[model samples]
Target: MQLPTTDIAIQTDRLTRSFGSNVAVRELNLTVRSGEIFGLLGPNGAGKTTTIKMLTTMLPPSSGAATVAGHSILCDSIGVRKRIGYVSQMISADGALTGFENLLLFARIYNVPRRKRTQRIDETLAFMGLTEARDKLVCTYSGGMIRRLEIALSMLHRPEVLFLDEPTIGLDPAARLQVWKRLKELLETFGTTILLTTHDMEEAEELCDRIAIMKEGVIAAEGSAEELKQRAGTESMNQVFIHFAGEFSDSKPNFRDINRARRTAKRLG
Candidate 1:
């Protein structure tokens, strides 16, 4: 038996970004297939977030271009946004709004029909294990709870592609595992194309079908976790990252700080 081939969900060519004096990302080329999990692995100042922002149509690239689900980010940002959901690292909610309230508001913003919005909100909350905390103010929710709620909000629109920027940044090990489990189910059930940025080797190895390792605004290396490790003659993904990112690279950005930025952006997402 033969199955039909799926088209690429994401494609970028010579993608570049700069902040006046500093080039954040440069000449980066990549592609992500439909229904697959693609991971971007990079340390701080390595341009992972910048690439994500450009691809998601949040930030315009300084040069080059990309397409998400067939809409060119440079030409049809609105069309691109319509087909994708972005879950930033920071929780996106008004502190005063309860979990249920925030979800409802986003549903309306995403244009989920008025009639189906309520049921959709309830279902998403339950799926994220946020149903019990639905009515509690976001200010009162713990870090993990808030993270889960943010994910639920991103899924409300049932987007064909989901961009998760360090989606489990603040979670504990157990909570992170739970998140991965939920994400796997979402990919299988909805055929969602997921693109996430992370420096965590274990997270990349477990959740990503393929990974692109970025350094100094370019792709240093890319492949499956095992393939990269083998190419580097290393025993683990961490070793592979270290090899490609280079030795004595103080110029590289801090991943921990980058993770914090991810959390902060969620509020803006």
Candidate 2:
């Protein structure tokens, strides 16, 4: 069935992925509205990353179908790619390059017009609060600064949808807040639909318009934070997660866990 209109940024119908006998994602159906901040919350090995890979066209589904930014993932993969930006768990900025240089490089890679490149880079830097450090080498940046720069690079081409896999991982509380602030601004300024995967319950509660909790390759629950709390008969997202997934981690998974999961998934593949 066709999605209603431009109001839908992403839609999936019975999307599934398997690694040998292990089903990483199974019959996953989801929809994200335009200009909304949608969160995918799950613990380690819960298939959040696998879902993202499928939507971003980094991996083909074992069965089923999906559409991103009005293009079919199966039939119009390039069209889907061109309309969306993905910021992976791993930072993509070059440490040797200055912040501005990194933006310039991506602008070129994204085929930003020659005449518009400099202006777009400056605008994105200022928007990301990186203008002051625009010429500083990325290696000199703080974790928060690097995250903002990575996000800036992703936005240079003005994609209709942005996928962020653990965008604030490894940052302190203050840095995480700053990133959240910028993300809200991005939505207001550009109306870009954001799909994010995060283990941080607080982050999801604060930033997401809606959230879907995944467990054992299926969606266990989905709703706004308040709705989830009501459903779980709890006062917090943490409790909500525990109620649905029957698991809890005091500390959210970090980059190490993310990498380890990827490696394991690759081995299975």
Position 258, candidate 2: lDDT: 68
Evaluated with TM-score, which candidate comes out highest?
2
> For this target, which candidate reaches the highest lDDT against the unseen true structure?
2
lDDT of 2 by residue, 129-242 (tens): 999999999988888888899899889999999999888887878988999999999999999999999889999999999999998889999999999999999998889999
Q: Model 2 compared with the native: what TM-score?
A: 0.92
* Model 2 root mean square deviation, Cα atoms: 4.7
- CA shift at 80, candidate 1, in angstroms? 0.6
lDDT for each of the candidates? 0.85, 0.89
Where does model 2 exceed 4 Å of error?
A: 1-3, 248-269
- How far residue 60's Cα lies from its native spot in candidate 2, in Å, is 0.4
